[model samples]
Target: MGANDIFGVPGDYNLQFLDHITHRQDLKWTGNANELNASYMADGYAREKGFAAFVTTFGVGELSAINGLAGSIAEHVPVLEIVGAPTNNVQNNGSLVHHTFGDHKFDRFEKAHRQLGIKSARLDGEHAIDQINDVAQYIYETKKPAYIILPTNLVEMEVNKSLKDSIPNLFFNKEMNSENSFEQIKSSINNIENPVIVMGHEVDRFNVFNDIKSFSSNNNIPVLDLGLGKGNIDESFSNFVGTYNGQISDESVNKYVANADTVVLIGAKLTDSVTGGFTQQFNEQNTIVLNYENANIYGKSVDKDYNFKTIMTYLSKTKLDLSLPSIKNADNVSEIKPSNNKLTQSFYDKAISQFTSADNTIVAEQGTSFFGLASQKLPKGAKFFGQPLWGSIGYAFPAALGNQIANKNRRIVLSTGEGSLQLTIQELGLAFREKLNPVMFVIDNSGYTVERVIHGMNEPYNDVPNLNYKLMPKAFGAKEDEYDFIEASTENELFDAIFKAKEEKDKLVLIQVNMEMKDVPEQLAKTAKAFADQNK
Candidate 1:
């Protein structure tokens, strides 16, 4: 509901609808290179703004954006996907459109989207407003993606003044305990001596960060988080422990969570990647899980599908007598010293840790960047996100672009592998066109380093073409004064690039960090081995 700008591409069917979107003074349209890139940008925008929207044409355009919407669905991000459909006349008559197959099946695309667990409705002029409201309400409640197919005839549909009144009533109604009903888990947890709070990505999607943070602080609880939702809580908080991903977690952090008598797991998803290939074994009897659909309290379960904020508000107010065990809450930052030696993976991790700060919004890609900085502590007020479940390649680049668009004042920083960057590298041109400046750390490790860690160390399929990443900005039409490129092959050179980037506030800095193709972070190597074991 809070989307002020929409990212999309134009096609023949949606050209008419595009005019109205373009004329709206409240919205700015960013025309991307492709629909997939547009959808990725929308996903990024929603990560920052809590709600995002993107437009695409009926069949061809919509299909291209479906993967990005699927990421929104799996990660619990709220994104509104507006599709421009062929005229109702064509739909009613079963006539073939230019974008459709010759068989004249216009409903194929929406049906395909239904398989991805999203709410979709093709709109006609009569019930368009009502349908939009229904789909939007579901998206907000579920914190997932929804599709609204708008026909060409409805682009400029004339309505009465009564319909204008409906605009102000767009907010979801919330009472003290209506949408979210909670019964106290008071007696179950009263005897708990050691309690730990483990958070996940849902805290970001439902906008419940403040309530959870306050609850953890007031109760004097140690907080551990999964890697998917890294920046939802302030790592600088006194009670914060390091990130926990099953056995891959820092030994002390994992041990603390394992030894806790009461574990409060808030919206944490135990997917294969986050759980170290289902290696996490929790004591269900001592755990209290508060998630999107239901609550599991100390071996007792609630059937009510509750929202995160209200449930958290109820939990924060409940009194619990918890005598916490002595736990060490320290940052998982790599402090590898700079030297004349070549940049190894450990030094790369350290360089990234120093490059990030409270002033930056960091978007780390799934493979190297995300796993490399999994437990790297951030300065307070820094925002971080990556696609863990969806695991799409080249997502962070365009998403960073969209994030910067949503919050123009924040400095956008990106850490991505070279192989993934090649997929959406064209978005850099669009960012330059929009007059956006972002600092990018391109991991030039020669090929797909992550895939090599998983199974194939020397497979030809995992190898990528050789290309110089330094010339990207100039080739993308960034003016000489608008951009700078730095190569960080040695440890000293790596730190030099980070310091130089801090000084140049107005220009885009692209750092080509050279490392061995086979080298990877220790955590990622272990996680990949666990994943490989599970597959066998």
Candidate 2:
């Protein structure tokens, strides 16, 4: 079994661990003949996947290939990692070895891996062989990219017992709602007049979106989803206050949350994205944060606090103190309409028309897609998933595959650049094998559109080789009848093709959108320029 099929980490780690990181998962082991670890073969796999991959010890100047690997893995996707370690017992004998970097080298590796938040472990001691199976199971269950170091001596050790207890759980620990915690939360809620709920990824992690929504409704509090929590509630819901991550750019939504008298932040880190560098006009004294760890009422400092579930339930049962009028008649929201740029606006309109269903989910990148696509409104319940923290190119494809597997019925829309798609092209195979019926919308302009916009690159490196994206499905082994190929060069064809694909079911569609690198939304264009100038 390969990495995907490996039920536990022990089986997968033994096969691929302590080897050069392969760009393509297939290269790890494809059940094929002529399996040689040649440099050309490894490089071919890397280039095909649009990432840098090298042998375990291939150094490219001061920065080795492992350096590049560390940087790439930091962008949110979980990875399975393995490293070479010196035998614990033999290291005391003072032997100079090239195979092992040094004593405590794994510590440095751990620090580097922490940046990516990928879990890691060492397979070195006498118990190392015995514990690997449980560690492997933990990695598979969590979907987190992990690392397991293999010691030179222990690699040959007999794996006899299962070490299940040593395997760490990657999932967050929810705080218990004790009687004291509940009382503290109830008192805090009762003292507030206008309360706003700030929700974030914790809602998704705990699978408590519906519970939180119900709690908010019963308490008559408007919910402002932090950027990470953008799709917690359906966007069209009357109580929805809009995205608090400054990117939403709605003045009314911003003002409402910023001016709240009492902010009940549940499962949200009131981080920079939600607070705009903490410059928003909010009352620190009345701000309450209920996280998985602990609850704290902020007033210059923490005042009253408790556990997350306690406060949510307490607020739900209490008499709502918010004086704000019903937001159902809210007409102050700035319209996301067309500008003088007819071509760009129309392209967005057509793209929006394609995924008109509530189940449609769009995974976008920080490239021109985020700037251009966010302008177009999604269907009532459609989600826009992006790598806001890292803004990495290749994340969307693989992460989308994982998410699609999680929610197979939803129409997953991947709006990304031609360059970005190259990062994880191997995911196409995974999607094909899994029969994920997502619309692969390629904004094919044959260049790094986002980079050029921000840096004004006149270099040859900015351009990319043109790819025949329309043939992606067939190339990846999808049957002809199981897919729809739609290529549109103009606005009319684009609109028609998008609608047609939406009408068709039980088929994967590739809509090769002929967009220009220069056709960026004006607001985004300005922001990019301002950001560039400020840095310069």
Candidate 3:
């Protein structure tokens, strides 16, 4: 209900619905090239604006967007998916429609959405307003995606004008009283000596960054974030340690987290990637896991009803002698000396680190882009978005589009591999059409570089057809003066391209950096080897 922007593609069934959106001067409609891209844009927008919506036609369009919807569900983002269906008469009569499979079963799509969505409903004439309210409430409360089917005939149907003028109050009052759960956590904190805090993506999902930051700072506890929790905390905080992912973590981070007497994990998911292929050693016995609605201490569930924010607020006010030994700081970025002027991953990493600022929102795609950018330090207030658990390639490009649409003032930097970019490259035209300016860096390393590092070093299955990435802007119908496109193979060329991109801030910029196929980040190499060994 509070969404500021809508993203979707136009279709026959959805045209009437889009007419309303187009007529409204207060609302902005982002017409994406494809339904999948639209859904991804909505996901990115939701991450920034807290809530977002995307519309699509019935079967074909909705099916294409299911992947992005599933990703929203996995990441706990609240996205409203409005599907435009056929006429109400056609649905009721079970007629074989173009979007339907000739079986007259119009509920198939709604049923499919239930698996990936927290809640779903089909709009009926008598109860459409109630259905919309319930779906919106569920989405806001659960922070997950919800699906709504809108028949073409019902686009202009209205029950009451008052429903359009006001939205239901969905925000719940914060509970101020500290309960037994808070006492239990306080006791746990007091009982343990060498306690540390481990944060995850949920901290951002639940909007508790400020509370967690206050608690961590007030207690002088060293904080380590999982991969997905990169931008949740101020990286410049003195008490903040580097990212922790078991053996893949920095040596100091691994030692501090692995050796801690009591590990406090807040909104953390022990996914395979975050835990370095499940290589982490700490178990429930030594960990206090705090979720959105519950708390677990030393393998025992707290039987009291507890809110995550309330618990964090209570912890911030409590006093504790957290005078543990300071963790060893990670080494600063080493000077990059590319041999024979060849640009290495280290050089690129350094360049990215230098280019990023507080006003930037960086999105990295799966594969080399994700692993390579993993260790780069983000500036204060800079947001980082990556789908590490979902690991969907080409997610960053459309996500960058949505993010830029949501936060028009901030610079959106998208780092994606050439191979991965091909999957969703059609969205580039939408960026041009929308006049959205985002700095896009495509790593042209031939093919699936991350996969090659894991297995099949020289297999044909890993090779991808090479395309001229610099010419994509022209192919996408961008005017000659509307965009800047640069290709770089050497260190100086790459640096100059990045510098030029920074200077040309008013227009979309694409920089294609070429590297050897075998070149991979050091951390990625180690993790790949671990995965390979385990599989063998």
Candidate 4:
């Protein structure tokens, strides 16, 4: 038994197996001291791997943490998980038990697993022990997570040959359909003079980040990253354009996209976030979406694409002569300038100038801050993480903590909204518990700015109780030596706090910037109007 070998429940098997697994060093363990920590250990493991973490429980205390885990996973980190189990003995005895509301003890785990793409299974009965080893092997091999049932009786069950032989068997089979989607893609590429390649998560999922860089270098194709795909490529690439989002009003990339006869989207999902809810102009007929699960050629959605690697390999070998070097070497590229709001830019610039390092990762929350921060230019190697798809508030604080845990050496800056900050503010205690260093910058305007922009003064009563944003770190139990608090009502104060936070590595800081609910991004405003009108 190895690291991966320790499965079912933390106490179900001995820790000896943890020493045998070659890759067990990477697992995050939530100790058996309590159920929450045990669950977090599993979550931390999934998060470190860049996969989603999930948990659902019918148990009382465990239920609160699991509810928090879903949004945390949905926004900051996407991990797969399932966890709901009541002792089968209680149910079998036909006694009035706590989790007897459902058919199975772990049904909540199954329900939540289905919501995401995660695969889930159960552990029950004496014969169910026969399957625990197989499930553990599946979790190890697939990099997907699982929630297992550990009855009180089975928690002490010894390892058996039935379990040992149940190690999962995995197979890889590929059958190419030569019917040819390539010809259509080729025709689209040839017809366009300025072709752009929009890269997304699929590239990273396929572990083709290097392949993408190489292909882009050889092909001289300009690259654009969709939402949540910011870190997919090196930001310093010559052909790289700014991120595409509704909050981004710049039309340079959109103009290039609209004019281009061929636009190759690699590993991108053309969902609402990436396409501004598909309101942004795009020539679907001339576009090619190359993804792991599917492909789009000349705007036709194909259920599947020849594997991403296979397509890239084929393109490299094809001797098709095409010269669009001008698109590659276009002497004039647009620069992402800070917005006209001098104060917002001043605060953002203060943070960026103070903490511009390759090791810094910015976590942006959706809402007003999303637009304000998106306009600021980040230094090379500084990655940005946000919850643009779900557009949920309060995700940045926890997500940043998660990212900080995953990359402890790097400094994390969280630019978030006051409204959303309240959602996961409780998680700040978790950050303090782990001693995770993430400086939070709250854009405090006293209300939901993003919601107001969409619906104007009627604002829909979107407001929360006032919070002492600057004192949050201390409130979450950070000692004087471990926490720094800064409030910025003016430009100089903001920059000073940012500089101090950036300079200090050992402490978690909270920089609260007083802001006004004015000057929303034009594009985001337009999107909001459309959204409101549609519902009306």
Best model per TM-score: 1
The lDDT per prediction is 0.83, 0.55, 0.83, 0.58
**Model 2 C-alpha lDDT per residue in residues 193-251, reported as the tens digit of each score:** 77777777556544456766776676667877765445545666667766664433556
**Models sorted by lDDT, best on top:** 1, 3, 4, 2
Point out the higher-scoring one by lDDT: 1 or 3.
1
How big is the positional error of residue 497 in model 1, measured in Å on the Cα after superposition? 0.7
Predicted structure 2: clash tally: 8
Kindly list the per-residue Cα lDDT of model 4 for residues 141-255, writing each as its tens digit: 3434444444454444566656445443422224465336666556556666677777776565445666666656666767777765665556776667666653344576676
Best first by TM-score, ranked: 1, 3, 4, 2
lDDT by residue (tens digit), candidate 3, 124-219: 888888898888878777778899999988898867777665674556645656588788787888788888888888888778767767777676
Q: Tell me the lDDT of model 1 at 393.
A: 97
Better of 3 and 4 by lDDT: 3
Q: On residues 1-536, what C-alpha lDDT tens digit does candidate 1 reach at each position?
A: 78989899998878988888789899888999999999999999988888899999988899999999999888988999999888899888989668889687888899999988889989988798789888877877777889999988888788677877786566664644523245445455566787788899988778776777777766677888888888887878777877788877778778877788788888888787877776665767778888877777876776354545677776667656765544455554546678999899877776777767787998989987888887677778787888989999999999999999989889888999989999999898998899888899999887888888888889998998888877788899989999889999899999889999989988889999999988898888888998778779
By TM-score, is 1 or 4 better?
1
- State model 3's lDDT: 0.83
Model 1 clash tally? 0
